[model samples]
Target chain A: MKVTAATFTNLSPEWILLGVVTLLMLIVAFSKDKKQYLAVTVAAIALGFSAMCAFYHMNETNQVMFMGQYLITPLTSFLKFLTCLLMLAGLLYGRDFITSRNMQPGEYAILILFSTLGMLALISSNSLIVFYVALELLSLPLYAMVAMERNSGRASEAAMKYFVMGALASGFILYGISMLYGATGSLNLNEIAQQLQTTAVSHRVIFIFGAVFVVAGLAFKLGVAPFHMWAPDVYHGAPNPVAAIIASGPKVAAFAFFLRFLLDGHNGLVHQWHDLLIVMSVLSIVLGNVIAVVQTNVKRMLAYSSIAHMGFVFLALLADNPIGYRAAMFYVVTYVVMSMGAFALLTLVSKAGAEAETLNDLKGLNERNPWLALMMLLLMFSMAGVPPTVGFFAKLGVLNALVHANMTTLAVVAVLFAVVGAYYYLRVIRTMYFESASNHKPICLNWDERALISINGLMVLYLGIFPAGLMSLCQQFVG
Target chain B: MIQQVIFYLFAALLIFSGVRVVASRNPVHSALFLVLAFVAAAPLWIMAGAEFLGLVLVFVYVGAVMTLFLFVVMMLNLDEVPRSKGFVRYLPFGLIIVGLIVTLMLNVIDPSHFSLHVNAGMIVPQHHSNTKELGLMLFTQYLLPFELAGALLIVAIISAIGLAFRGPRARKVQDPSAQIAVKRNERVRLVNMEAEKKS
Candidate 1:
């Protein structure tokens, strides 16, 4: 735990993000209107550097820093890399959408940088206190970002609802942590795990009681059903880019947060939390799929689909073994890529005074722009878990984990719900290809978004065909 | 016996203020009651030998935060909330839920399960400073959390400004660059004009 130059080197990713956030704040403060767009460039470059830093440290694992309250591991570093890519893509994809509407891109970029910092910190947090602080840091900016569309009443309402529910969730986590601390006399995850092993039955009950609240808070963050009341509204109401950011990076970070808190901290109480995850995942799969079919708004539909996707992650998580965790990690990374591509495409189709909010907005997209349309087709197919796409492999990995855990029935149910979820994603594809254009205007995208979206969309197929690389990487980290 | 008496006195006052905080009809009254609750609880903490926490709680919560709360309550121009008809309808269910919660809390906090010796007093080590110890820990063992909390505050400020700060759209602010970059001839036409009389 001694501080060293190597420790700083190991923590370069977090330090880079913190430095970038500070830089963005200063830019936002002094920059003129014409120069404000520079914030995006600055943030994107910083995110790229941070991501590179994370990738560089992939081999250096189990390096504890900040007095054992921060940890570095292969899995966390990889997650940090993914999160940085997510933020960078979100800014790149969101720029045109935000600028077209004359929103303050500077503020938007700074907020995203802060949120990225929050996510990185949350990913590496080893203590409950750090986790809670990082959670707030992640959330506060998102609430503002959701309300970025200042004129939209829907956006303001969504921001308010998100803020209130997020605060409640934070309260739940704090109370849960307090209870756990009371029971175990420690706030560090490793300490808590060790304490639980020797604690009495009464303390165990208290730990379980505290853990229920913690799981509930985590469910809210993950946007699983029974506590997913805010997702569809926030997604439907926020600007396209904001929703895309929320959907992509935060979910991955929340998954890491889950692993840190539950698996790392309270693994001793797996049986107690297993029942909770079972109920949540089942509800999320059924509800997310069944409700998504009726959603006319594309954002709301994606929201529901994302819920169902998280259900699959939880299914993998419930296996509670290395293979299960590895599958879960693979599933989350692929899902972030797919969803980010999907939302980026949505931003492309959106024009001034006419957002691509409905299915009809996507009608005849192939006639308008074949290349973008093809990318959308790939994303939608991947989302529906069609073959030759990453989503299929992701689902296959989760199901394999489930079956390996001898939960064949659960796997069967998961596949059934996935089929139900496929209906909506396929509906999107049908709207894009089979139907004719209503607007008849060609979809336009800048080179940056065009190239990024193409690469993102093709990744599904690329990883699907050669799943070994990412799969083995996940196994290496989790194992 | 005297310590027990003092503890019971403050505990009762704390519970009374706490109930009043919820039971008060006016928000201003409720805020005052909350302040009272904090005041009552501080002495209870002090009686338990955590005098530093008690003093800090009074100074921060009562002296500063509650005053800010009162200002907000007065400025918000909120109307009196009318009682809803559904309140009476839900009374039975609410009472049942309350009873269940109380029972659960009692089960969890059953003092009989704990081994407690009701000593006459808590022994405080000579020259032991709670504030100094807490400060040392905050700067050393707990520095990460302390720093992260500061970062969280900074995030809160940024979010508040980002969401609530209405800049050029709300007010006509001066551009210093434009002011400083002004060309003398362009800004003021130096055309020779005939001297006009007072008319």
Candidate 2:
């Protein structure tokens, strides 16, 4: 194929999303209104348009865009679709919070758009520079969003900690890239792989060092054990909607990038990094579950749960088999749904201008709003990997892949951790059902919040019952 | 010959500043010394033929970022930093670690190992240096990772902004939101304007 700049100019659905976001940002900045309904409407339209574009793109075959740097494969398209969907849900869930705070709705829309752009770039990135740029594009906006609640000292502290640790990780990643470039004299993944095939491993000491550093940098993003110190703080502090986006969308994108860079590009060095990943996964699973048990703060507990979930994803990555990759992708998709639903309920349950941080806040949720309680039940169950919910299928897929890869011990450990994880998730359910309301006020759900929560909750059940279609899509991409 | 002289001079300066950074009693002075060390090291990196790293080290670490660090250090009251007498207990372990690092560095340093001869005959004019080549490579081949680093920088910037802009309470200001949202029209208005004018 004779690649040309014109080939790169073909407007993908992501490009349409970028345009919509930019346009929405401009409108929000310029327009004045007592009610910022226009901003919300525009954001919804843009996200919807992006989702439609992703669907359109999915029908096409894998092809390189932007002169082979950006790829538009089915995998990228699907992940982008999922990211856009989650962003839309988050914006809807956050509408009340944004309005109550009197924050610039345009800024929120633009930041989300920028994050979407980053996620899109991350999924499609074939080159190292593009990948890093995408990662930043996604992350930087998130740091701002974390501190968007300007009056909250907790938010500021969380944003600061996340930012510093993130910077150190970036520095590590850059140093690794430099070392890799120095060793291979090339940056293209295929070219580097070809070069490494001929080069003796012992002769490429810099390459190994670079690989380790790069993986470490990626581990920081994945929030695996030892690199996950910031996750709980950030999650506990960030607004529920922002936390939802952080815990779900960017995480999935990061894992996609990890699969691309580590599993695909540096597949040869699997033996070198697999043990490290194993250690990280094991530690994340054990510590994440154990610590989460003691947390009264619901958000903090979920944050710990996320770390443990990431461990399972890392285990799949360590498996380095096609089934494992597929399972990981499926697991991530389900996780996004579960997290979005859970956080949506969190947003719905809280009163206007207040954050729902504690388990006590969820008390009497079942009596106040049974439907929302039901949604929360499904989400928690999904997260706990219970049967007839998407969470179970997600876990089953991962466990099956691990067992298939002859990782019985790791699978056993994962099963044990899953059992541990169930406790924290179920604690919320218990709080809602078994406990009485501390305050007798019925929780009100907004139209957008209701719609998002219902969809997220139902999707978990729908996917769990019939995971074949999503599994097939994942299998096709990996194949 | 000029390049070698510059490299050695900067290398010595870097080491001197690094030692000073560690030994300086004042935190502000230590920060300044660290900046000096970083600045000196950039020239050494340039001499090692890694122009990209050299320029970035100066531009990012020394010029903008380190200055900001120095400002923050200077702004802070360093009396809060713990001055423990228990440091003597850990001094031996620290020294052992340093000694091990020095031995490792010595073992790795072989003059013959770095003997990849540069093609001096093919040197480009200073006006047409390898900056363009570097930029092309950065944008094209390494585009993903390059962009990811840029995102990390944005993250850093956001973090810094968050840290610097402590809340109104921290800054000893009344809540701006409360003040801004107050309906001033209700509190003050012109009643009987003509009578007021006559008065």
Query: Which numbered prediction scores highest in TM-score against the true structure?
Result: 1
Q: lDDT tens digits, residues A395-455, model 1?
A: 9989988988999989999999999988989998899899998788787777888899999
Predicted structure with the largest lDDT when compared to the true one:
1
Clashes within 3 Å, all models in order: 0, 18
* lDDT of prediction 1: 0.87
Model 1: how far residue A381 lies from native, Å = 1.2
User: DockQ of every model listed?
Assistant: 0.49, 0.25
Q: Put down candidate 2 lDDT per residue, A161-221, tens digits, no spaces.
A: 9989999898978878876776677766666777778877664665776777788888888
Badly placed stretches (over 4 Å) of model 2 are: A1-11, A352-354, B15-39, B45-127, B131-199
What TM-score does candidate 2 reach? 0.84
